[model samples]
Target: MYAIVEMAGQQFKVAKDQKVYVHRLQTEEGKKVTFDNVLLLDDGKNITVGAPAIDGAAVEAKVVKHLRGDKVIVFKKKRRKGYKKKNGHRQSLTEIVIESIVAKGAKKAAPAKAEKPKAAPKAKAEAKPAVEKEAPAKKAPAKAKVKADDLKKIEGIGPKIAETLVAGGIATFADLAKAKPEKLSEIIADVRGNHVTDTWPEQAKLAAEGKWDELKKWQDELDGGKA
Candidate 1:
């Protein structure tokens, strides 16, 4: 019977008494090692495949020896530039012999605990008297919706920063006009690159008051949305 198992980050198809060279393991020579990552097992008559690895299966082996592999040379060259480089490396390896493949073991997997059945969903609470709920509903959203300003029309505000301002509850021109420059910067703290908010509140004040010609004259004299 043979089993495919993973060891030291590599996989090998191994059988009892079979010796395999694999990446160096920390175990000393002559110490026993067990691999529980058995991906496939074929016991002469039956074949068992693991979803990823068999739960109770393992491959037992003995560490025979540790050694380094033959040196491999690596060379590099650049034409015309006359650059040349060379290197060599040897891999650490271990020799191990498979001693046994245990399909099931004394250390068997624990049976999974059964999940408790879900409690039936609670029934909805009975509705209150219509007059009681209706009174509160009328007063719930008392704050009227304010018309939002085109904040991008402000010199220092771009599309992304405009959305950020709106999300921060500064949706209208009047809101922007009253906002402090430092506070505006805090609102759009995540906007890309540094922004000079020095003149934004001033510009917003003009836009909120419907003085477009004056706002435009000031914007034309500004640079990169900065005062």
Candidate 2:
């Protein structure tokens, strides 16, 4: 069984015996704390969701330790002005081990454990060792396949953006098309009043062009007339 718990203004999805670090709380080490704000609970086959929070649902945890985060150095300086300052800070933290997650009115769930796969039985008898063969000098690794005009098939990409990306040596559909999370923020800044980030245009471009396996989902849906 697992629980969705709220602690120090953060929500965590955790299971029994798992240790989590959160903003420090005023509980002593080895003390027990119960998080009553259970947002959701799951016991494999069934799930219970809270209305804001579940009444009488709670997760029990043992405070393992009170600790401090690594010190961070903060430095500020103004160019051409001889003004500079440095400061160091460390954040307080708490380590807690989830003990149990219980549904208020339901019986405890059976513990889930991972079973190891059994080993295959030994061969009936060891075969005589054959004279080693050089196996055709093992073929060389193949070069990565490249598609030069993959961007042309995507619906939303214009010739200008295609030229811009292709000029930057991005020739294949498998090339990174989606701007990274940080890069997306910069793109948002460049667009000013537009909310293009919500569209994830680059990812959509890759999906439409069939560069990733996830794109097959959309293709399948379209084929099924579900689009």
Give the whole-model CA lDDT for all candidates, comma-separated: 0.80, 0.62
Of candidate 1, the 10-residue stretch with the lowest lDDT total is 120-129
Cα lDDT tens digits, model 2, 64-127, are: 9987667556567999999875444444568999999978743334458989988655552232
Q: Where in model 1 is the C-alpha error above 4 Å?
A: 105-227
Off by over 4 Å in 2: 105-227
CA displacement after TM-score superposition, residue 45 of candidate 2 (Å): 1.2
| Global lDDT of model 1 | 0.80
| lDDT, residue 195, candidate 1 | 59
lDDT (Cα, 0-100) at 105 in candidate 1: 35
Query: On residues 72-92, what C-alpha lDDT tens digit does candidate 1 reach at each position?
Result: 565679999988754444555
Clashing pairs in 2: none
